[model samples]
Target chain A: MILVAALPQQDILRLLSAQSHPAIYAQASNFSVADSEAILSISHESSFWKRELHFQQLTQAARNAGSYEIGWDGYDAPKPSDDSINQGIALLNKIKEAGLSPSSVLPSADGGIGISFRGQNGRRALLEISNDGSASYAIYGKGHPRLVGEFSPTAANLAVVFNRLSENL
Target chain B: MKPTVQHLSKAPIVEAIIAFALEKPLTDSDAVFEQFYALIQSDYPSRNPVKMAQLTVSDQGSSGETQIVGARFASADGKRVCLVDQSNFICSRLAPYETWESLKSEFERLWKIYSPLCNSRIARVGVRYINKIFLPEGEDMSLTVRTRPEIAEGLPQSMFNFLVRLGVKIPDPQGVLMITEAQLPTERPGFVTAVLDHDLQFRINPESTDVWSLLDKARELKNDYFFASLSEDVIKEYL
Candidate 1:
């Protein structure tokens, strides 16, 4: 319940003038662009484009990881499902956005993805994105402590875990 | 003091949309549609399903299918439209561009009605403005077009027709300003028209219910890019 701004009411004069003026208060229009051959046929490229490329890379990696054969690991591990890959990307985006670099984003034998984080004091953390897009995380080192719980990326409730991983054990 | 944008005699907007994504999609499609139709029936009476054709190849021969991707709820006048799907709820106005104030007011009014029904937070908010610069026959496009050459990513060879798209970063709010420009064909020969579309958007905390500021900022940015895309001589035509 915060006040973003105090927006002024539309002036009475402008409202009256809008009825008769050809130049009304409307913003610019571009509806026909979608149908234009020039807009739909082609697009320009930029060598320095990286902002969108980051997410595209994540999605692509997840897709590639999901393509592994079931017996590729020499065990009876199943391939990660589409849902798990999507959830894995969600977790990857969170940690990437948190400014922490992960050691690797690997697919787990349990048909999910694990994001391994290496922190200071040689501490380690692992976030497992399950097949249903839910998460389970573990922090290893110093008796392993009490670092076992489900993580919800939607809630962004990973602050404590993220801090612990970035700091000392 | 509040700054005002000069009303152009010819506003170039083809479609302006304010889009919102729900935190979690409403799973009950039929119920959601019935409830939403009930809410918007007064303002947007006509309902039409938006479908996308899909071609599927399986063990059997390829089969073409149509998927109900989304739906559009339009007003009786056909000027205003509301587009809704599982996760997105968008309010749009087509041509005969009106003021931003009217659009904002309508969005707020509809959002209030649709919010409780969503049972989810607004995950993302975005505003898109599409402006097409129209030039009648014999009018020179060089006057309006900028000097900076935009390269099309498609075919390396010289192009007979192309569209330029650029995603500019907004450092302040951490969003992408997707600007799309393309020259369009005209019904009448030699008449030139180009479209400049600006869409400003960013992800936000679902809990952050205060969205008017973002919407207002998008409008401001839209206006800024719209005017900047044109040269002084061409802008004079709009003024």
Candidate 2:
């Protein structure tokens, strides 16, 4: 058995939350340390697990960066602000409350986080939350014109968007 | 609603699987040999079986040395099997899945044989189902409404290849379900093979919780996702 250093409790919590994208508590979840490490490894193959592997890599990279800052896609991207992470967490909670799962939760290049949803009907929706508590959305469906708008990250508004996406699911 | 025989299908959608986890790494592979052999010998009498090994290779491309670390036991028919290591326990049905009930029963039987030998408890449990949907010959992939339009659109005219994965928390049964749909590589003319994989998983204290309940929940989620993923017309035609 390969013995990797056990992550700290707080760090584990943060990593789990980031990996699950809905702020999942560590106590309520059963996750393999090996699987987590595999996800973080750059050598791992990408498949259906790609979104999760990327999230784990982001979390580890953020931890290595120190001070809860996330590197947005390895570029010289803006460091995610604490406020942005919190807002992203809040948005994730809202997404879950609406019974919707985003395809991925990724840190944006502009000190924010973005959640994406794809439908089987060629519809796609993205919800991006910035550090300033502002949010914007863009939705596109096959044959139909793309819809772009801004909305507060409230449960009701997120539900409306989630419902639209679910229609295509 | 239970799917009928015509809809349920003997030609299973799932191709293969390896679903299990370990609480702690096993130190001795020989500790459970007697029980393991006794349990599997009935189904798999073959003398030659693959064993898991640890290998060390030099960066200079020299021959690598292998050391046995674990073992995998397979049924004579090769349909059912179990893989065991210090901390991990995985069992899989390679192909032609009979039913969830059979798989669950087999898992339970194998776990019964394994639970006594391993000292550590089960920390996590995950059930993954891989479904392969073979499109009819000459059928336009776009014309099939089995999946949501967002996932079906924007395909190359000659070869349509795409992958969509989503992870959602199951509020009722208390777990996470990861759904993935992708186009598979195929050589058959005018045929497209799409795979819809559902991985329903949860972390739990194996000692306190009932494994059967979790398996039931996983099956429920699988059924829900399967039917929900397809259009009524498609379900009627191919389910």
Predicted structure with the largest TM-score when compared to the true one: 1
After TM-score superposition, the amount by which residue A70's alpha carbon in candidate 1 deviates from its true location, in angstroms, is 59
lDDT of model number 2: 0.57
Expressed as tens digits, the lDDT of each residue in B1-239 for candidate 1 is 23235668888787777888777777776677779889889988878786667888998889998988666787865668887777777887877789899988898888888777777787777788877675444433345565223444463423233345555667767666666665443322444555676767766798796688988887887777676667766677777
Worst 10 residues of 2 chain B by lDDT: B46-55
lDDT of 1 by residue, A1-169 (tens): 1111111211222322222222311222432332232211111111011122344454456667778878668898778887887777766666655655566677888767777766544577888877766778887766546467776756656787677665633
Could you give the fnat of all candidates in order? Answer: 0.00, 0.00
What is candidate 2's CA lDDT for residue B194?
62
Indicate the residue-level lDDT of B144 in model 1.
57
Question: Against the true structure, whose lDDT is highest?
Answer: 1
> For residue A120, what is the lDDT in candidate 2?
48
lDDT of 2 at A66: 30
Candidate 1 backbone overlaps, count: 13
DockQ of each: 0.01, 0.01
Lowest lDDT 10-residue stretch of candidate 1 chain B: B155-164
